[model samples]
Target: MDVSKIHGFNFPCPIRFGAGASKELTDYLKANKLSRPLLVTDGTVAELSFFKEIKNDLQQKGFSVEVFSEMHKNPIKSDVLKGGDAFHETGRDCIIGIGGGVALDVARAIVLRVNHKRDLFDYDDLIGGDKYVTEDVPHFVTIPTTAGTGSEVGRSAIISEDESKKKRILFSPKLMARMVFADPLLTMELPPFITAATGMDALTHNMEAYLAKNFHPMCDGIALEGIALIANSLETATHRPDVESRAKMLLASLMGAVAFQKGLGVVHSLAHPLSSLLDTHHGLANAVNLPYGMQFNYEGFEARFDKMADAFGLSKNNGNRVVDHLFEMNDRLGLPTKLSAIGVEAKHIEELSELAEADFCHPNNPKPVTRADFKNLYEKAL
Candidate 1:
């Protein structure tokens, strides 16, 4: 666990984590005998210096590299389809995801699309479509840029419909990345807003997963630890990032994704609609509405909140304290604590509530979330 030196981990997947882990890409490619790679990333990251360096480094080492960056901030089916096309057209031997959640999701989806020929949404896991995922996928690798969503270690992709903007889960164990190069150096340059938003996103995942209605004790342990890591490091990571803080945030982000196999809850359900309708960043939406969602869940889940309070290092084991601390944390991070500050209005509440009720995450909530409850939460947050 020294952030300055490389450490290898094997849990849900194989991850090479540390300061210079990304430099192993060329050696990995040479050993695996993969000459051509399709690198999937977002538009913003495709232009960054590190991304350019990665691409140039591969080329200089005599490897053929093709890049696919045509994707929305919130990914859709077309994004995966386009990346799949790039993979086939360029005869890519593997798919290497090189940025944040959006980029990693697109890369995982394209890995599925490489061999599965049905309509993209036909593979939606919500509809028992994983049974149709019988074909083998291309070798996949991930190098995460942002410490949010932890999609680098995830086996599922969240893709939305083009016209409806409804999210779909394309999932299978076959979609897991063959390897992950988790370099904290890539995350050091993230601006304050992104660092804060993504850090909150990681915290939300751990909190919601710890409270989700699943019976997984292992996930509960992991979630609480992830929360504690963020509680200690998020502010420093956002305001004055260094090797240790960025590394901890990245580690906590990965732990959040793994812990959330117990599942997410109302906060994600509430946040997804905002990303679909208002084009708000997913992490920012979660950051703003997280406390309200927690407040709604605290009525009968006091014991769970008490555990979370301990994770935050509060002497009192109280649900109310957990809610208040979340609000204060948002303010300290310079993130908006209210939906109104982020352009959410009363007019959008009805539609957002409908979408929230239709969302997949809330079904796993510790308590049931009705459409009426969704409306009420939005109103309270507004």
Candidate 2:
């Protein structure tokens, strides 16, 4: 793999991927005749040197840029609304997402909110809101700075109700980015903990997608390969960063996002509650709950677990070994091995279980997950 060069892919979306892919950003915008762009990102990324450089490049090329960086780690409806207001007030013609998941999600939601102005949550794809997404969205592009969430290539935004903190999905094919610059060089400066948490998030996406009860064999194959890539590179990316490791992780993360179009399962259901109820980082929540969720899913589906074990290069037919690897991976990545370490108390279990039971991801689990099962998993992980 020539990690030094750029490559283009048209699967799931149009992506310019590799070490220097971000250099093409201005050219793409020029070709589309978009002179003014609203740059949406999180606060931390907005301060980073690489992000500043990207912003600088656009300005040097004489493009008018308006930046909106006020957003939470878990984005809410107001974030999208605020960004939409920025676009309208600044007279921007396009939107460019330039951070991790939170930034990308808000940007996509802003794209949806810009032209189709009903109540923001009224466009929630959960309640048949996508049918109302008939208007043309502003040209949107993304340049991912993290290998987690893979929202750079995704067509949906997971925004929450600010007061209730209940997640709502704002989805549409029109929400897809016109182009993605997936430059691994942008991820090279990630702190170790961020790398570990995001890498584990990628792993969880692949694992749950593969085990989802959906019948898409193409997604199944892509999920297994995504599992293999993360298995080979995640620890290295987290502990000792390099372009090769970051490249593999970025590719695997994108693959996970694409594959999970088949569906996700119990792990996401377990993770979402932690993010909403406890305000934990989404990646870290997924990391902590991953092994426990896999353990719960392993019993009735030993053969499926064996397939994942094969991806991890474990000895054949031993489903428990697959679960063991997940636990071991968390430890090596310097992530917490239990819920208690992340501030989840016994008092929080019932509410968390309720949230998990109501989450949208678990119905696709190969085995049905009851509220009782969620409660037990929380207890065991705690």
Candidate 3:
């Protein structure tokens, strides 16, 4: 992949985007005068040759690199504290998050813990907590290895609360990474199933963001374009895994995160509980629930769905056509069409509904979502 022609952009954040952009890490670190860096990643990504190669390159350049890779898929509050201990123990001056959403989120949370004196829950975004995140944290860089979640560029990190078993959003401008290396090459080796699920997650983000009852035209425009990009390249990126397709999906994922600052809807509200309760893959949970969520939201946002259908190139521009297109896309991507297919049962509906109703994302939905509405949506998905 000749990424020499690729360029960097500073759209609210400095991003080095292309196939081989990961190779610029040394230059970025040097330019910022950051040497003692802690690399935060997941255990699986730490085993990859890409991570090993970067570790070796940094070591050869005499940069002391420490790593913390013990975080969970849904990182708990304790994991953030443990990561903070490692960060301080190693005397790391900066943090480089080098994997998917989990690692990036934990990295940001760890940075928060490094400087703040309060407990992690004190800064939860749900309870007017953004003011508590007042300290200037360490310099942070994010390199995403997956094309989902887009936590690399996000200002909030979702960490799980142990006792409640619910995901908590910790939001602050300080959590945003100072730099992001959006290299599609990092996602090339991902399995087709993962690629499909994550691609659908990205699509859901853009679609739901567009449908949310927000007054941001800039975010609306970005969301629509993000959806178009995913519709065009997701299937190819999943099945064939080429550079162009991967690059497009990666870019779309970033756009999804950027646009979703406007808001997300019931899809994320539904998916977060699945992750907290069933330990389901976040992307897969979102993929399974997205169409049902869209269907449930369609009555209030028929014009939005019509626009989305047109974006997907459906001949008929209507809400039903949008739902049909999503079903078709799920089939083509080999994703589960029903919640039952993913081990979700009828018994789980009430609890999932309660959790979904209480979720921060529920209020932003285009259609007002109640506990009863959530139960009905769960039943429909099942």
Candidate 4:
């Protein structure tokens, strides 16, 4: 389909999408007059051929690129501080985030830290902390290697506090990537399990956004379409890894992120603590807990669940049908049906619930969630 030739677009920021779109990165950097950019990625993605190729290409073009792969799976405040130190030490002028949520979040957090005087948590979104983010960040670009989190398109970054193990959302318009290079080919080599988990994360984002009691019709429409695309293409993208399926999943991931600017719900609220405490993969945590979260909210939002059921191609058009479809899909994807299977235990439920109840995403839930509700949902998922 000559995916690279597809037009670049801007919803809020420029997006160059399709296969091999990442190859334009060097030109994009030059056009913006950004010669010294720090490349933030994980150790694993740093070792990939695409990373090496991109670094080599930029180096050959005489760009001063320094790679920082010290990001953790669940990015911590300390990690961002270290990243800030690296950015200053290298004297880099721009930031290029080049992986999934962790790397991207760390990159954005580093940008926030680069010129700010206050602590990282001072910019937490919960306490109207975004106001403190007054300074301009370095020019930023995002190249996503996974079709989840949509951190590339997002304006907020989730970084955990080291002592509390609580996830903090750092948000600002300045945190948005100036450009996103979304190339499906980058995700072609993802293992099937990761494909399945991250695909479900995308689904959760769409569903939660649609269900949230928000007034943004624009986001609602985008969320519904994103759900349908993920429902139709996720299994194939996981199993076969074709260009079309990969591209659809990538688009769906971006749509999910864009839509969730309206807000997320109980699923993310519950998933955050699992990642913070158990160190579970964020997408996998979301996948394991999504159905239980859906069940918790189903009675209150029957019509919303029915719409999602229709998106999943269920003729019944009911909340129960939607939940059933999720279970079936999870089984097919070989995702753990219970949290216990993924190292979450009964003893940890209370602590996890407390953390979930305090999460920023918790208050945005359509059905009000309490500490007891959080505990019950955890028990149900377990």
* Candidate 4 local lDDT, 218-323, one digit each (tens): 9999999999899889999998779888988999999999999888999998998899888999999999888888888899678788888888877545657887
Q: What C-alpha lDDT does candidate 4 achieve relative to the native structure?
A: 0.90
Clashing residue pairs for model 2: none
Error of 3 at 362 (Å): 1.2
Question: What's the residue-level lDDT of 153 in candidate 3?
Answer: 92
Models sorted by lDDT, best on top: 1, 2, 4, 3
Pairwise TM-score winner, candidates 1 and 4: 1
Model 1: CA > 4 A from native: none
lDDT of 1 by residue, 1-382 (tens): 5888899989899999999999999999999999999999999999999999999999999999999999998999988888899999989999999999999999999999999999999999999999999999999999999988999999999999998899999999999998999999999999999999999999999999999998999999999999999998999999988989999999999999999999999999999999999989999999999999999899988888989998999865665799899999999999999899999999999999999999999999999999999999999999
Q: Compute the lDDT for candidate 1.
A: 0.94
Estimated TM-score for each candidate: 0.99, 0.99, 0.97, 0.97
Alpha-carbon lDDT, every model: 0.94, 0.93, 0.89, 0.90
Off by over 4 Å in 4: 1-4
Give the poorly placed runs of model 3, Cα more than 4 Å off: 1-4
As a TM-score, model 1 comes out at 0.99
Instruction: Give candidate 1's root-mean-square deviation (CA, Å).
Output: 0.8
